[model samples]
Target chain A: MRPKIYLFGDSITEASFDDGGWGASLAHHFSRSVDVVLRGYSGYNTRWALHVLERVFPAVDSGGEGVGDGVVPLAVTVFFGANDACLPDRCSAFQHVPLHEYKQNLLAIVSFLKKRWPTTLVLLITPPPIDEEGRLQYPYVENPLGLPERTNEAAGAYAGACVAVAGECGIPVVDLWTKMQQFPNWEKAYLRDGLHLTQIGNKIVFEEVVTSLREKGLSLEILPVDLPLISEIDPNDPLKDFQK
Target chain B: MRPKIYLFGDSITEASFDDGGWGASLAHHFSRSVDVVLRGYSGYNTRWALHVLERVFPAVDSGGEGVGDGVVPLAVTVFFGANDACLPDRCSAFQHVPLHEYKQNLLAIVSFLKKRWPTTLVLLITPPPIDEEGRLQYPYVENPLGLPERTNEAAGAYAGACVAVAGECGIPVVDLWTKMQQFPNWEKAYLRDGLHLTQIGNKIVFEEVVTSLREKGLSLEILPVDLPLISEIDPNDPLKDFQK
Candidate 1:
């Protein structure tokens, strides 16, 4: 079976296959090497994601006869906290989880995945810095009160919590919140509408994710291509190359 | 488990997850609904592809206890014939298969898939129209003799055979050969390297595939989204909606 990489997150990850999405870039980068599987759920907070964890990655039988839920993934990225950071008093409060609960939920997720695929690499990605002005201009839904449902400050708290959880778990973390802020005019450059990523923003996430995997010895340079390259096949004895 | 759509073909299909690939578009289109799996073999022709088919789609046990190789896909696309269309007397002769063999191989593939997944929607895609001039300009390998390894005429034959095979099997076939030539400046517009696709070419394939699937009762409109939409969840009791 091909080694698989799972992207588990919310809307940000869910829309990662769009024209220039980070997920699509990952799929392209890992083409013929690792299969990238998206398990993103739009509008999901860490609390809601935690509720669906087991169903998404169900436990296999002790004997492993059934090979339940397909193969164990090589790595899984937990990229929630976007919706979790929504302002509790705003229109998007329904998707909000308390700051403390968000961190705890992420911890639970990492633990569950570790138990399921003991050796699988676990990576966490903090929510990107929000653009309050952009959010006001492009709300996902009708904002009758005309207030942004999320703020960069509120999202930073979730991002910090995500980093803290990653540190506690001894795994890698991609602090998108901090990374995006490092760029000048990031409000319009990295984000398309204050929350979701722009193409360039997607590229950054893709690079960060790849770098994280590379540091752990999963670089494309080392990963074997699935089949022999066309140039490798001898014209006279082609079948010989297809031998198992 | 999410429904899967498998793309089985040669290099053109292999590179379908590239920056502006049809496979990426498909994945984006089917987001939150079906999973698109790529099983493309670069530099592989029908003969070579047939040799590896069984291994790629291994048979499951009668009782189906293990889901031997995961869930059955909802649809599978058999896209080949590009490399097979290479001119027999040219440098790419090594990858060539006789026209008759190409048709027979496709028939066998369709038979095998139907037996394995009786209800699975099977779609065939013909090789796109080639540009002999473009082939010489952007040769994949060194061409000291300054000769094109593939020809538009040969590709048309292979595409015709592909369509015939699909007709014999009673499955839908994307006549990319004919469809591409219908464009006024197709030589440069559709094909990037005479053989592979340009962004617009990929978009065309994406649309054709979606249309074919739609005709067979698999349109995105009818396919239920995997989970509850955020709007559908009651803010007062979100968990109540996730009970399933």
Candidate 2:
């Protein structure tokens, strides 16, 4: 049986952006040896994903006869927290759960999953940085300046917290933020309005993630890249603006 | 402007049966002055709902319109924890969390909401008891045995904990479990599988809840019941076998 891998997180992991999402691309790279299940929902943060994992994943009575049965992915990848940082009510003082609390939520998920699937490799992926413009076109931004400065600070802190928590739990992390920063014109690599990544950006993310996994000594096979599909979305297409 | 009341919880408050959920029915009961938003998801426990409130509710960006400009609801009714009694993962040492922890989780939400909406009326509802057969048949039951024995005990303890915690937080609780026990043939009124209530069962629940609110001295108006359209399944339909 192929190793089953479950990808859980927010839109960044869900919107396989025309099949360029890290999860979808990772599945293509690993081919039959690794089956990936995308359990990503746009606009979800780590806290919400933890809730989804708790409420939805376990109670699923798939009965082993469903389309995705027996494809128990041996790995689970988690990418979240972007949306959490930007939510106004949550960021407000009264319910202001600092990065510390966010870390606790992430740790709880890791602990819960590790206990259930002791050997299932878990990868915690830090979300890519919000563009310098700071505007996420979709979800209707109330502030033209995009996310508040505090939110950005929180996002970065959240990424670092994820790394620390994952390290404490003995799980590996795919540092997408750090890796994506290395790209030339990192902001342009993302789609216009700047929240989600462009195709090339997603491919870059997928490559970095796979490389990290291979370095960890996992015998992950990389399938040939579908170049034609990847090139269809121009790196400079200004007219294709869609708010994610 | 009508007062905004947000009802959050599991199946019981969700009114899972064809009978309008408690939240919806409550909204109908207060049709003129209260604008109740039923934000309940079935199978969600307190832990997850806290996360949802943190992440999901905030992102609901109401475009600066609506009551309180989409801030936390003026009156938040929290009825959760039924599913929390279920084991989150196989490795969870305790199938159900200790009552102390459940109290902590419930208190966290109440405190957070209270701090945000200082004057927001927070209603903490104790869920109804699971019947002997241990199923929540209003919708369906995945586990006929309901929760393990220890879990059921923990649930009862959690109820007391909720009362104590709410009292400490200066919040009010509607003890549905205690009230439901007073009704003769409570089991028969509930769905055959046992966990969830039938239409009549829900009506009984609604009456108790309203009575509790009135006793608390809230000058809320209760509308006449229009009787929501329910599912065709009857609790005593002969063709429906519980064994299946």
Candidate 3:
């Protein structure tokens, strides 16, 4: 059974495999090694995520020996809060969830994964910092929402909430919110819009994710060396390795 | 359960999910409705594929009564012939397969999938035309192979064979070989190297793949309307839709 890396999140998570996407980088880096399952839900926040998470990732239903007991994935990345951090009681009113509820929802997700798919590693990524000024200059994809529907400060707060939850849950977290800002001229540099990641932003997350997963034993150096190379096997008996 | 579309092929297939990839395009187009599984094996020809195919996509073993009989995917795109059509008499002899054998391998793949995964539609994509001029300018990824290990004529022949096989099997085929060349200035515009696709090439494949799948009844217009929306469910009873 091939290993799978599940990416769960909102639009940023949704667009993780876009052109020059972080998810694409991961897929390329781990080509022939792992399957990167895209579970990105566009326009979703913690509240909606909480409701749909179970269907997307059902628990091991029957422990007493059943097909549902397929091997747990190698890792699951929960990347929410981008939409959740949209200023509650502000424009684009539908997607926003209060900061406290976002924290609680994240905790529930991490805790559920821990209890159900115990073997898989869970990593949380805080929403990247938003650019209110930059956003006002550009029309975000969710065009109906007014400019500055989300603010860096508000997103930063949710990012902090994410960190607190990750800290309490003992999970690895890629603080895109903080890391993206560490670079020079982050406002115009990292974000594609005030919301999504640019190529640079995606690469940062990709590198951090690979590094984090490697630390958790999913090494980048460990290519699928175990699989039989074509030339290594007799051309006439190609199926031998597979059959065994 | 989400419907899945499987992409199976060689290095080109392997890189299909890369940034701005056709695979990513498919994923984006089918977002929230379907999952696109990347089953790309690099430097592999149809002969190697024949042997390893079952392992990657095993037949529904003991369908009589078993959980292993999970839902078959909506479609599977078998894209080979790039490496298979390697000029056997010319350079880098490792990946070369005789024309007759190449045809046989294609037949075997289709027949096997038709019988094994009966429910899933299998679409065959002829490898894109090779650009000898571009290839000479740029050393192809398979560097051991000569500057022109493959040729447009050679690839086209295999593509014809592929079309013939598809016709005989009565299955859908994406004649990329014929379709790509239909445009003027095809080579410099589409192919990055003689063997692989550039951004334009990738987009063409993405569009063709989507169009063909839709023609086979998997329409792009259809959203996953069957699944319950978050708003439809009570926030306190998140698992309601999932359990049902």
Candidate 4:
């Protein structure tokens, strides 16, 4: 039985089930060695995700007789905090939890999971950037202020904060913000609103993860890629615009 | 124009708006030196309040308009993090941010306000406890592994985390949790849901804030009470149960 790779996050991960999300690409890319489980919610933040894990994960009851066989150790990747940034009223019903709190929340999850699965490797992925137009055309970027005037800088700070927290917790980080920024015309590569990624963007992120894993000495034989060839398609054909 | 002391928080502060909430009582208690602005929202957390401040405060723009005259040095007392503890799935869309994130979010607000009003004294209040059986009749407790367990410990932890963060930020904390825990029957003191405060709880929190202010050397003469008799009302009277 293949080990499971749990994709836990907000819309970015949840969007994987759709035609152009990274989850689909990731699943295809690592089909043989891992079973992918998407536990993404559209408009969730770190605080809420921690609650979900606290309530739902424990209920899964991975005991062989209860949940089923092939329920061994799993790799969990957490991506959250975008929607949390856009809350209308910071202290109203929702908290635009400061970056520090976001880090602590992530740490709590890592700490909790580490206790449960001592050897489980947890990966933290910083959410991608929201384009200048300020729409989170993805599932949820509620920032009423629109993207911060200094969005790249703000996004970088947020991602750096995530990396710092992950480093403090000894967890690995996949810096999606930097990787996405490297793309030429990233805004164009994004969907209309620029919060969610275009297919090319998702593919790039997926490849980054694969590259990171390979660099870490992890075997790729276990994770398989069964998706149709991307190379056969024209690179810039107007009809090839998958985002449309 | 009297100097304004804005009292912002969740239900405990919101209740003051009604005959039962301590806001009115506190207003009466400190009417001389301060003009208390009760901006309280029920079912709110630090996240939402920060959002509100971001939106509302920016409109109060402290720039060249000569506008924020009376509000320039406004003092704020923030009491929140109760509804945040009752999240069905902490990560769900229903609001209830996780504890750690809640703290960071609160700190962000503090930082933002401090930048706006460097001399403005901000008070951080950890809300009191809710008796699960009395006010909170729902499945407020977590039933991990099918074993029912009270989440009061988690709630307490959330409060403690808030205190820690506040302490780190050098903000004053009104320790409502410690004081409220001393009550004999906290559940009965609360309204039906065990989440919000009873009239008694609100009063106690209100007194604590007043006492904290006096301790800070703020003069009470400028803000004299209009109604001094309300505090003398018996907390045990059934007819006086303000939680309803």
Candidate 5:
């Protein structure tokens, strides 16, 4: 009866199971214990995610709200705002939400889930910094407006705002935007296209996410010891020790 | 909430998450959809497994009993008998449960699980036939006894008995014993040491497990279309179609 960890966010979280996605890394790391559920909605921001959360999660109390029907998660990583950070004038009009509202929406979402799963640990992940040069050329995510759609500076603002909201809400925050920039020429080294994570980018996020999790004391080191080490059990009449 | 599927077996199931294990294949294949719980206890046979079942699984009617705390799984794979097929006269006495008891133990395990999770699909996997020639060479599992630990003949008999029990229980069976032999020189190609699955063997089990699950109409195709496909959703407001 391992506890569940929900990865809730955008395309980054959704692609966690990709060839070398962070989700796969976590899955491999937490092999036999801790079910990692992916609830990432690609191309979704805080606004769209808020609309879809009820549908995605079952209600803790069915009270007609039809959400939170699933088992209570042990932890949830709410990683969003990449799409919300889309420059309103430059990017798709449909995806943009005012930065103030974006922060409020995140707080509301976190509060809602925390109310349902009081024991669940919440980790907020700010989207990685955008890459303007990569956006102008190569296989970047298509922007309908023909404009760059987002600049590293703008997305980084949303990332900072995300960390602020997480701080106010008293939850762990993985500031990938700031973290990825630590390396020189991080745009190509970390991100694949302008936005989505490459294998290396995924690794950076994975390390940061794991580091934050360890800081919160919900570390991976506690995983292996959680399951029954059957080989260590007494060979003959092992049922004695097998008893709870 | 994604329902769980338990990979219940010995070392084979235990190592299912190992780099190229079939369990990982299933996890990767059904990412974000099914919870593949690993309940593999190494070096344990059907006899020990039967003893540990109540502890490993939740008791249906806890009525005073403190078990049955976990979520009801969608399915369970009862794969055992590799060690049970050990020669009683020549191998480690503790592991060698006679073939007759092995069949009964499988039935008891199934009946117990069915009683708790009546709706859960049960898939019994017959152990891969032991490769004596391979076991004697290079790096096979150590056999403390001078005589070979298991014989293909004995394992095949248990496999036959397993299919028979499954037929009686109206459950599915993955007959690796017979299936592996279908390939020429399967010893080295399929069996890494002699008993456990090789990389190719894991693929074989993964395919068979998936095939049987599909036969039961629980294929991965049934995964819910949860996220909003930006292209599919109306550009203006797509929340209407987002409803179940």
Candidate 6:
């Protein structure tokens, strides 16, 4: 079976197969090398995600390596906190996960994945920065009060917590929150609806993910293409290269 | 685990994750509901593809049910014959398989897949109409003799054979060869090269595949969402609906 790289997250991750989505680009980049699996649940926060973690992934086994089905992923990306950063008093407060709980939930998810697939690379991605103005302009739901449900500062707090958790767990991190903010006019440029990514924003995430994976020795350059290239095939005996 | 839809084909399928490719659009369409697995080989013909068929798909098993891993794909799309349509005397003859062999190989593939997982929906996608004029305008390789390697008429023949195979096997097929030419100016509108698809062409394939799958009782409206919808969770006790 082809080695798999799983993308686990919320709405942003759910939309990662859309045109110009980071996940789609990653799938293209790793075509014939690794299967990029999307396990995103839109509108989900870290707390809500915990409930379905075991069902979505394999349970811990006594063998200490590989699942019972013998499908251990090469890497699993945990991208959460966007919904968790919602303010408690807002209309979307149901999705709000407390800061401490957010970190703990992420840690729990990473621990579960690591325990199940001992050698699987666990990478954490900080939620992209919140554009309060954009959120107010394009509210996902009717905002009678006309207030943003999520604040940039609150999201930053979650991003900070996310980075700290990665440090505690010794895994790679993609600090999208800080990275997107580094750009000028990011509110209009990187975001489509304050929370979701624009095509350009998706490219940024794709690049960062590739860079992080490359640093961790999973570069596209090193990964083997699944089958023989056309140039490798012997025209006189075409089946020579295809024989498994 | 989420059910999977496997895409098996040639170069066009290999490049299906590129910008505006049909496979990526399908993945987005089936996001969260099904995992779209790409098993495309860039220059593979139906004959060459047979050698790796068993490795790519599960071998025939006892009990006439799922494979050893208990993973039976929900659907598999067999999209080949583009390379096999190449004229025998052309510079690309190495990729050609005789018309009879082409049909037989497809029959063998469908038979193997059905025997392995009888319940899995097998769909065939006929090669798209070729544009011989466009092939010369943007030749894939040097054509010193200035002769097109493939002709629209020859491709139509292969497409016919593909459709016939699907009929014989009692499986659904997307007749891209006929469907694409229905539009005026399709040579430029649907195809980028004489062989590969443009973004609009990808959309056409995507729509046709969806329509065929829907006709076969795999409509998105009927497919279950993977997890609890945000509206299903109670605001007061969000975790209530998430319990397994």
Instruction: Note the residue pairs that clash in candidate 2.
Output: A4-A72, A4-A73, A4-A74, A5-A73, B15-B21, B29-B223, B135-B195
Residue A101 displacement (Å), model 6: 1.2
True contacts kept of each: 0.52, 0.00, 0.47, 0.00, 0.18, 0.65
Off by over 4 Å in 4: A1-244, B59-70, B88-93, B135-150, B190-192, B221-244
Lowest lDDT block of 10, candidate 1 chain A: A61-70
Deviating ranges (above 4 Å) for candidate 3? A64-69, A138-147, A223-226, A229-244, B60-69, B140-147, B223-244
Model 6 over residues A1-244: C-alpha lDDT tens digits? 7888999999898899888899989998898899898888889999888998867776435464664346688899999999999998887888899999999999999998887877899999999998898899888777777799999999999999999999999999999999999999998899998989999999999999999999999987888888888878887788877764
Candidate numbers, best lDDT first, in rank order: 6, 1, 3, 5, 4, 2
Clashes of 4: 47
* TM (chain A), candidate 3: 0.88
Runs in model 1 with CA error above 4 Å?
A61-67, B61-68
Model 3 chain A worst lDDT window (10 residues): A60-69
Assess the local accuracy of residue B137 in candidate 5 as a C-alpha lDDT between 0 and 100. Answer: 64
Model 4 chain B: ten consecutive residues of lowest lDDT: B226-235
Ten residues in sequence with the least summed lDDT for candidate 5 chain B: B62-71
TM-score of B-chain for each predicted structure, in order: 0.95, 0.72, 0.87, 0.76, 0.88, 0.95
Expressed as tens digits, the lDDT of each residue in B1-244 for candidate 1 is 7778888998889888887799989998888888888888888998988888876676655554222455778899999998988888877788989999999998998988888788898899999999999999998766777889998899999999999988888899999999999999999999998989998999999999999999999988988787777878898999998897
What is the C-alpha RMSD, rounded to one decimal, of candidate 5? 4.4
lDDT of 4 by residue, A1-244 (tens): 3356666777676665444456645544443345455566555567656655653344233342211222444577778766555433421214245677777888898887777676666788887876756453432324454334224455666788888878898768888887777768887785446567777777776776666656554556544422212233232341232222
Clashing pairs in model 3, backbone N/Cα/C closer than 3 A: A19-B20, B131-B194
Per-residue C-alpha lDDT of model 1 across residues A1-244, encoded as one tens digit per residue: 6778888888899899888889989988888888888788889998888888866666565554222455778899999998998988898888999999998899999998887778889999999999999999888877888999999999999999999999999999999999999999999999999889999999999999999999988888998787777778998889898896
**What does the TM-score come to for chain B in model 5?**
0.88
CAPRI quality level assigned to candidate 5 from its DockQ score? acceptable
- Could you tell me which 10 consecutive residues in candidate 3 chain B have the lowest summed lDDT? B60-69
Candidate 2 residue-wise lDDT at B171: 71
Could you say which candidate leads in TM-score?
A: 6
**What TM-score does structure 2 among the candidates reach?**
0.41
